[model samples]
Target: MDLQTLTYIIVGLTFVLYIGIAIWSKAGSTKEFYVAGGGVHPVVNGMATAADWMSAASFISLAGIVSFVGYDGSVYLMGWTGGYVLLALCMAPYLRKFGKFTVPDFIGDRYYSQAARTVAVVCAIFICFTYIAGQMRGVGVVFSRFLEVDVETGVFIGMFVVFFYAVLGGMKGITYTQVAQYCVMIFAFMVPAVFISIMMTGHIFPQLGFGSQLIDAAGNSSGVYLLDKLDGLSTELGFNQYTSGVKSTIDVFAITAALMVGTAGLPHVIVRFFTVPKVKDARSSAGWALVFIAIMYTTIPALAAFSRVNMIETINGPEQTGVAYDTAPEWIKNWQKTGLITWDDKNDDGKMFYANDARNEMKIDRDIMVLATPEIADLPAWVIALVAAGGMAAALSTSAGLLLVISTSVSHDLLKKNLMPNISDKKELMFARLAAAIGIIIAGWFGINPPGFVAAVVALAFGLAACSLFPAIIMGIFSKTMNKEGAIAGMVSGLTFTVAYIAYFKFINPEMNNADHWLFGISPEGIGIIGMLVNFGVAILVCKVTTKIPNDVVLMVEAIRFPKGAGDAQDH
Candidate 1:
């Protein structure tokens, strides 16, 4: 079959599967809509959590970024995966014991204040919307490339699909759909990596292939290592060495810390813990989710290395033998039409060389490397179609998760809890569905007109989460003295500082366009670290100044932490 036909088939099949699941598991009650009726098995919930946590940024963009940026991109691999350790160890079980529908519920009850809950709802909404926008963009990109539609039309199509399942299924529907999405995305990711690894290093495992020796001309196995070759090639192209530090050590450390904390604080991820029946199950589920995520996280570096080497080899030749630009393969032509990879015949010799010539520089869009891999490697059209379906799965799964969180916050936390305390469960469910539909429409608009790169936007979302929600949750769980005043102050301070810093550097600054952003010499990607520090500092200071904690709030905190005999606390 042709690539287009195969893509349509794969995408259509996945959509049908998701809609079918939604119809089968249509949520009838508020509990069912909010937390899948608290009946999801731990392992099944773990897979669903993995799908929810691993967003479009992870599935569609991480490897592509690493392929171009090389080892310096290890921060993403380490930071993103490492955060789950914190979630499992420190947050998940305790929150599960709290038996709350949302992160704000934990904060509200622990702090003994509706104000705290409102603040949390604001933070959750901000984080989810910012994060969802990127996923929508990922969906649009996949549709445009594989389905051959305009980006706007692709986004609208993606929005409708999400609206259908998310509105019908709620968390119950989204959880099962995410399980399917995880399978599709992981399979798509691993298949390409396995193929590329075997082609390059005679190893099926990409991690092993990344460190293996390169085969030289005459089939002589050289002692030159993959990393060493990559380092040399990178510098030749006016880029940093693959293994060396392009970012300051402090910046790297801070960014990693912020991402870890942010991952723990994200509302959609935290809410997944509520679905598990037991507190211990939540902790175990986190570990299982981490293992699933690590399967991809560990392999990404290898994919990056192999793709880098392949890209360099294809664009630049060994010093002795060079292929003419006119002789470039069919895959090159296909990608070039997408304007993702373009070359000019430098020196007018009709041969593209890997040299630092400003006028003759070859431009390659990093996003294309992963999406175009099957074509580049001469794999069958079905594999390419699988990739397209996988990308959609990744994006749609995450969007559904985020939309659920947003809708529930509005209908359950804000409207039902605060405004209409007498509202019926059926009315609440209807409002939740309405909120989800509206959120999907807004998110779809942003996807069609994306403001920035997928990774950058995700990082900013992490920064917001890190600054606002993380500190409050950590202190609420760990510190007995943290008051409502302290929690509210911390969230507002952290969120404002982080968002303002990002806006300043990303939009307001003249010279600090993404490439040049630095505060105390840290890039914007790493600035979340600074924002997190300020949040913690301000929270502590405010707490010290107002050292009074309510007696009831103190008791609530104690209960959440010491749930030894609490036999599967009922979800409120």
Candidate 2:
């Protein structure tokens, strides 16, 4: 059968499975909707959390980012995964013991102020929207290629699928659905990497293949390391060595810190811990998620190396010169239809050339690299189709998680807890569903018109979280004297400063986005680290001048810090 037909069958089956899970797990109360009745198993929640954590960025964009940026992309690796370690070790168990339904709920009650909750609601909504935009864009990219549809149409279709399960299942449905998605995503990701690894290096494992010598066409050693060969090929095309980095030391540190702290502060990821029945289960889930996440993360660099090698050879031919444009392979023609791969013959030689200089004749979008890898490697038809399914699973899983945060922010944080304290449970549930649907439409618009590439846009969202939420959560848990005035002031100042800097460089004045225009040579993607410091400093300064914390609030903080057993935290 043709690739397209096989893709429809496999992807359709997965959709049916998701829809069925949603129906079976449809949440009946606000508790189930918000935290899956707070009875989810650690192992099950771990799989779901891993799916939510990976998102489109890990599955679709990480390898692509690594392939193009070379060594600089290591920041993402360290930042994202390291941030999870921070979350697991320092925050997850304590937050679960805090017994709050959402981040805003914790901030509000911990700070003993409705205003603080409101600020958290705004920050959560903004960060989630920023992050969801990338997932939706990833969805559109996958659909446009495999389904032969325009990006906007693909986004609209994706919105329907995500909204259906999200609105219906709430956390209950999304949790189970994401577990299934994790399976599909991991399976889909590993199959291609294993195939390409054996094909290129004659190794069974991609991790070993990563450092092993390349096998020549005749199944013999080529006497060249993969990175060494890639570096040589890169120099021939006037590009920097594939293993080198260009980002400054400070920028690297700043971006890595931002991503790490941002991951810790993300509202959606934190809420996963609340789904488990006990604080200990939260810790267990975090450990399992790390195990699941590490599998995919370890394979990424190898895949990036393999993909870079395959793509360069496919486009420029084995001679390291150029290939005739008219005779370009089906992958180019297919991707070109989506307007992602562009070719212009500057030399009028009818041959395509890729380089880091003005002689470059092709504009290939990084988003296509992972999706196009199977096709470029001449994998079987079903394997190619499986990638499309896998991409959808990755994008939809995270998108659902983000939409849940947005909805809960509106319904539970803003309305039920603040605006309509007397609202009925049934009515609040309805509003939550309504909020989720509206979030979907708005997120779809962002997907249709993303500000940047998937990884970059997602990185900016991380910065936002780092700047606004991390300090508040940390101090609220660890510091008894962190009053509401301090927390509110810190979040506002940090968010405002980070947003203005990112908007100025990224949107208002694109020409001034260079290092000369940056603060301490930190790009917008890394500015959140500065923002987070601003938050910490402002919160501390404001706290010293404010009234002392009430004795009861101090006890609450102490109880949260030294928990005795699962679900042992008292309601404040």
Candidate 3:
């Protein structure tokens, strides 16, 4: 089949599978809608969580960024995966023991204040919205590439599919759909890696091939490792060495810390624990989620290295003079039509110079590297089509998860809990569905006109979560004296600080948005670490001045800390 036909078939099949799962797993009650009736197996929930967590940022953009930035991109790999360690150890089991349907539920009850719940609802909504927008944009990118449509049209189509399942099946449908997505995305991701690895290094495993020596066009093996060749190529092109980093160590550490904490605190990620049947299951599921995530994370480095080498080899032959424009591969010719890869013969030599200097004849967008890799390597058309499907799966799964969180925050926390305490469960479910539709529309808009690069947009979402939610959630679980006033104040302050910083840099004054203008040399991506510290400090100071926590709330905190009698705890 042709690429377009193959993409339609594969993407259509996955859509049918998701809708079928939605029909099979239709939710019947509030519990089912919000937490899948608290009956999901740990492993299944783990797979769903993995699918939900990876998003388009991981599936499509991560390795692309790594291909350009080299070792500095490892911050994303480490930050994203390491945060699960904090989730499993510091948050997940305890929150599961709390037996709540949502993050706001836990915070509201723990702080013993509706005001706290409302603040949490606002934070959850904002955080989920910020994250969902990027997912929708990712969906659009994939759709545009595979379906031959503009990004806006792709986003609308994805929004419709997501709305159908998310509004119809809620958490139950989303969980099973995400399980299917996990399989589709992982398989789609690995196939190309394996093919490219074998083509490059005679190794079936991409990870091993990344460490193996490069094979020349004549099939002669060289003593230089793949990374070594990549570094040499990069340096020759006037770019930083591919195996090393250019980011300051402090900035790298801060960015990693922000991502780790943000991953732990993200409402969508945290809510996954509530779906499992037991506290122990929550812990086990977190580990399982990590294993699934590691599969993609570990492969990213290899993909980056392999793609970088392939790109360099294709453009600049070993003799140093670049290929003539007419002699470039069909893949390069094809992508040139998309304007993602372009060439200009500045010296009128009719030969391309793919380098980092301004006079270089070739330019490639970092975001297109992963999607373009299979083509760059001259892989089968089917692999290219499979990648398109995988990108959509990644985008759609995470969008559904975030939509659920946003909808639930409005229906359960804002309306039912704060506005209409007497609202019936059935009526609330209707409101939740309506909220989800509206959220999808708004997210689709952001997707069409995304604020920044995919990964950068995603990084801001993480910063918001790290700054606003992680600190409060941690204190609520671990500190017996955490009060409503303190929690509310800290959440509001941290959220405001983080959003303002991001807005100023991203929108207000783009000219001044650099390390020189940053506080402590922290970029917007790493500013969340400072915001988190401010939140912790503010919450603790306010807690000290406020009246002591009620005896019941203190006792509740103690109860969540242990695993015993967790099965009997009532979900408030």
Candidate 4:
């Protein structure tokens, strides 16, 4: 009945469902653990991939970002979804045809070098760990607010749930569970968005609501557009216009390109392509996956617009410049208790002003907006419960995917393939489960003590993927002459440059804030574009200075590109 009780019930039910699925589908062999025995249907695989891809960043943070940042947030919407198009058109079919167990398998064999594979493993692990930290933080934030627990404790509970399923089910367990998660999360996200849309604009579709005219009490058109109103409000509060072009055109173009490429290049996501039975299925799966993702992606802008308008209207009005602290709404009181949203009456006035006062700056945590949407909109308690469950589903599904990748790389790729060639499949599977459990523990700890915002950490992960892994994969596939030396050099250069750039801005230098960052005035968020260029350039330069590639490696590259010879290219 109450919010806290409802949250606990929802989370508890989802956890039970996941554990039950894990038990029912427990993996018995190395193949099952790694790729679900490669028997998954295309549509099912598509849904699972969507679940794996969305993560906490999509479910918890994206709309909140758009709500505050306005049209500039379209970069995230376009870049992330567009990356899937790249994956489907440029990467997925070919890689699935190559039929390797992991991204490194393709790199290692294609380049004919153990060193190249090792570099890929290093890069993959870096990206996964960085990304998982954010998901863990999302889980903690949802739990702390809904279930009324400390963030650390919430993270521990999340870690246990991830370890339970990932260790027991492996890819087989994770895949089926993710399908269920996708359903839960999508339903949770859409219900409140649709409700809010209908209430504000008398339209059922959020996309249309974003462009619709605001109606006044007299039923006359307000004449001012939603985007224009948002722009004006933001400027008044010392923030940039919501719909105006704040970032340079070049920076926007580069960031969007990098995100597209990086999405296609992520090792964990690429591995999902390998789980389907046929190469053709993999290609089709990408399209279906994008369809599922687009449902949320398209609606997010509308949610951002509605929430922004609602937030402003509630805080600033003729009768009350801001909501009175003592008489604040129930949702406000509930969220304030979590310390995610806070208010102060700096002027000792009964009314609250939504203005940008330094002392009265509202500390509305971004993650809370989606979770608290039901309460803010006065939806039924069941809807609020569903949101809590959905947030957990989003967080856990991603954590499972990341942990599975980490475990497989350690046990299957490194230990079984290289360190202990004589090891049995059963022993390797055992070690894989162990590695997954250990990885979950480490990830949970970081989630309990997050380093930054959810989107910031996710973007950094994308940057790393763009810098290191993307270059190596592209060069390895396209260039017949690229050798181990060149690939290694490129990866190291890209990794070092991107990481150093982020660290410099994030910690070492205060003045070079993300907004002011530039290589010729490019924002740090868009620096991945430059880092990718450096990778390609360094790889080509190093390859030219070195000897020609071996004849066998060239043949391998040819085989990877052509569908006819791909059937025999599987690792081992």
Top TM-score hit = 2
Give the TM-score (vs. native) of candidate 3: 0.97
Clashing pairs in 1: none
* Higher-ranked by TM-score: 3 or 4: 3
Clashes (N, CA, C under 3 Å) per candidate? 0, 0, 0, 2
Whole-structure CA lDDT of model 2 = 0.91
Candidate 4 residue-wise lDDT, 1-572, digit = tens: 77678878887888899999999999998788888888888899999999999988889888887887776778888888888887788888777777778887777777777888888888888789988998888888888878888889889889988988899999999999999999989999898888887777766888887898766656567787777878877777777778876777887887888788778788888888888887778887898998899889999888888887777766664342466666766887788888888776667776556655563446777667788777876788888889889899998999899998899888867886678878888898989998998898889878877775445567678888888888888787777888888888988898888878877776678476755556666666767777888899999999999988999878877876875422522448
Candidate 3, run of 10 with poorest lDDT: 563-572
Error of 3 at 8 (Å): 1.4
Q: What is the C-alpha lDDT of each candidate?
A: 0.82, 0.91, 0.87, 0.82
For 287-369, candidate 1 gives per-residue lDDT tens digits of 78988988888888887787777766776665513458788667677666656677776567777665444634577777777
Show where candidate 1 strays beyond 4 Å. Answer: 215-222, 317-325, 342-360, 452-456, 512-517, 565-572
**Model 4 CA deviation exceeding 4 Å by range:** 215-224, 236-238, 318-320, 357-360, 452-456, 514-517, 564-571
Error of 4 at 87 (Å): 1.4
lDDT of 3 at 301: 94
**Best of the two (3, 4) by lDDT:** 3
Write down the worst ten-residue block by lDDT for model 4.
562-571
**What are the runs in model 2 whose C-alpha is more than 4 Å off?**
451-457, 568-572
lDDT: worst 10-residue window of model 1: 563-572
Give model 1 RMSD, 1 decimal: 2.4
